[model samples]
Target: MIQPDLVELVALRGAAHDIALHARKPVLARLQGAHRSAQRGRGLEFEEVRLYTPGDDARNIDWRVTARRGQAHTKLFREERERPVWIVADLHVGLYFGSRLQLKSALLLRAAAILAWVATMDGDRLGAVISDANNQVSIFPPRSREAGVLPVLEGLVQAQPKQPGEESFNNLNKLLTTLKPLLQPGSLVLVLSDFSALDDNSETLLANISLHNDIRLIGLVDPLEYTGLPDGSYRAGLPGRLWWLDGNRTRRLWQEKWAARKKYVDDMANRLNLPVIRLDTANPVTEALPQLLREPSWQI
Candidate 1:
């Protein structure tokens, strides 16, 4: 993968392009904000209510109404009018190889940078988790300050793939377990992965999270990663191997098997209500940036 600084620069440029030209029409739905007015309790429209937990903001309390009702009524407004996005990036070793201009992981970093920039630019808090294992997770609690994006970028740049045996036995599930407590209603989660390691339990965890947060998938790939050499002929330095997969387990080179797995992943994303932003390892991220910035399927 390219260095983090390079990916960060590319992302900043892409985000600027989207913000300047795309405006409210960015291809990514999570960049868009949904309005939630302050609480007046006039009708049945959903109101945002945070339980009167310790350290709750006192200024938000509806004191006048509380005095009238003769009970403590902490005010709950509609959900925040600002956008808040959570990004989960996979640094698994599988994404480290690419047959194109950049590594698959590099492309993911660029995509994440764009997301981070857009969310922060829209005055929304941006939180991210760089998960390679249970112990290697880096979490930045949501915050709206523009400066809040730095930590996420830094984490991405600094991240390294988990060492052998250092990798989590259940990376996605472990990450989700940690994520559940931090998430609140109406959060947005963007997961960037090759979808190579997802299992049944991990899928369920993701589905559960989607009930409260908008979850989208950015599935990364390289042409050579899927379709083996054309004409079924072998050549030196053809490309990297898919060691973690089944067909490739026999130390054989084959693209057909990789294609089958890729198709399965695409189908799974569709079934999970996760929209995919496909990335070609050989192409410039700018080529795909415009499509990614387009309206999402749900928006359509």
Candidate 2:
């Protein structure tokens, strides 16, 4: 596999042409704003808190106020052209396994690169949280795309384990817990992970964050993980720590675990009412991401 370094990220610039920031259609757009939208839905800026009305998104409801005043209220937002975009880059261990095409780590790196390009080109502020092996680094400074995004790209490559299963086990719950305090109410967070280490705490954290911010889950998946291995001896797992899946029992067990993982993610997303974008490791992330962002539901 080609190294997921700065050069690779730079090459992904062409993949995000149609990726536009979600903006509230401002009555008067700023002279030097990001992208502005004439059509309106749930854009970025927090406009005001008003009584919950029909057709209002319940996700934006302020639960604390509702409890105190014994009346439902909603947080309203006008789109901020230069919205803050946060990417949760999961470079934890166990991501180096990919049977076909590139590994999960590469897919994530490319996806993050594409997103950074889209945000920077459109003038949206870009930040990132990169996690690996029980540690995480947050890039939350205001910077030009070159200044801010380059570090994130570098972090993505550096945080990943030298090889898969190298003991880099950063739990999703831990990462999200740390990330909660850093995010603003109207920020957009794209959690790019395989959901391999999610727990009940992770679900709670995700729900809590989504209450005040727009959260999207992007699951990086590999076909081999879900499908049982074909009839033949095949080496799998990390380099220097390889294992063979020549037996039917092992493949079956792997398939079962993967199915459960997929189910849990789906159930969690449904419970939280969050949008999820699942990208196959077999496909080109550059090509797929642009198409995914254009979908109406993903316009956010």
Candidate 3:
């Protein structure tokens, strides 16, 4: 059953979505630098004249060039300032549990909210991929209009978590194969997942994705998940068949689980060459988001 508090988290993420900065690749991606280039369309300002080609448009012909060189000339151009931002969310059932105020699935909504706001704020484009058991892929090409962000949140609200039986047919590897091409050069890719090692294919897809865009991996984990609940007898099973088990006693058996999970997350981050942002399910993303967003993209 969905928790009431979790529903609130989703609503909060939807309400606050729209805090993003315009971004670009550093001018020196090849030489190594701490920033990406923010180049945009060529201004209409007059530039020096160049000889006109056979197919040159007469409208662009420089009268001064024609007069001085006795031949028509034209101006060159740069592309317009339009960047795209693509976001993928993971809501596998594994993320549905929380020992605290919220579950990992609910926390993802917060991250999505921050991303939606940022992507739409700077005249950028937006797209989304929901990596659930269904492996659904919804792509909304980048648009500058104000109406874009809502569709993204709507998609998240409607997304369903993957079930165990579903995983047998649709895994992350097959999912990423479809997702990779959706990203254009310079797009910002944000992945929100509990990131259990479900398949080797997911790793390969991530590696391939890194070749074209900047990727951020957000690890969503609950404190209780890492540290098992204190020993106590809790009813398990339906009605008359119910039985109680010692929760605290079982926790000691896997107390180091969080440490191991951290190592796995770190190892993946290292392989993908991306930064990992760890957040407790109980914590709100807004608390640390501004800092994360403001941090130089080049650093990650």
Scored by lDDT, model 1 comes in at 0.65
Worst 10 residues of 2 by lDDT: 34-43
Cα lDDT tens digits, model 3, 1-300, are 453333543355444443445444455652443223543212233545789999877888888768988877887654434456677777665665667766666677667766776666555667777765465566655665456667667666666452223233344455467678766666777777777753467767888787777778777878776777677777654345677768877676656776786787788788777877777876656776666665665232
In terms of TM-score, which candidate is stronger, 1 or 2?
2
Report the error of model 2 at residue 212, Å: 0.9
Q: With candidate 2 superimposed using the best TM-score fit, by how many Å does residue 188's alpha carbon deviate from the native? A: 0.2
- Give the distance in Å from residue 145's predicted Cα in candidate 3 to where it truly belongs: 3.7
The most accurate candidate by TM-score is: 2
Error of 3 at 175 (Å): 3.7
| TM-scores for every predicted model | 0.71, 0.77, 0.71
Error of 1 at 123 (Å): 2.3
Candidate 1 TM-score to native: 0.71
On a 0 to 1 TM-score scale, where does candidate 2 land against the true structure?
A: 0.77
Which structure is stronger by TM-score: 2 or 3?
2
Off by over 4 Å in 3: 1-77, 160-171, 235-245, 296-300
lDDT of candidate 2 over 97-167, digit per residue (tens): 67678888888888888988888887767888888744565555535667777887888878765554555
RMSD of 1: 7.8
- Pick by lDDT: which candidate is best? 2
lDDT of 1 by residue, 65-148 (tens): 677776656666543555457888887666666776887777878878877776776566788878753346778888775666
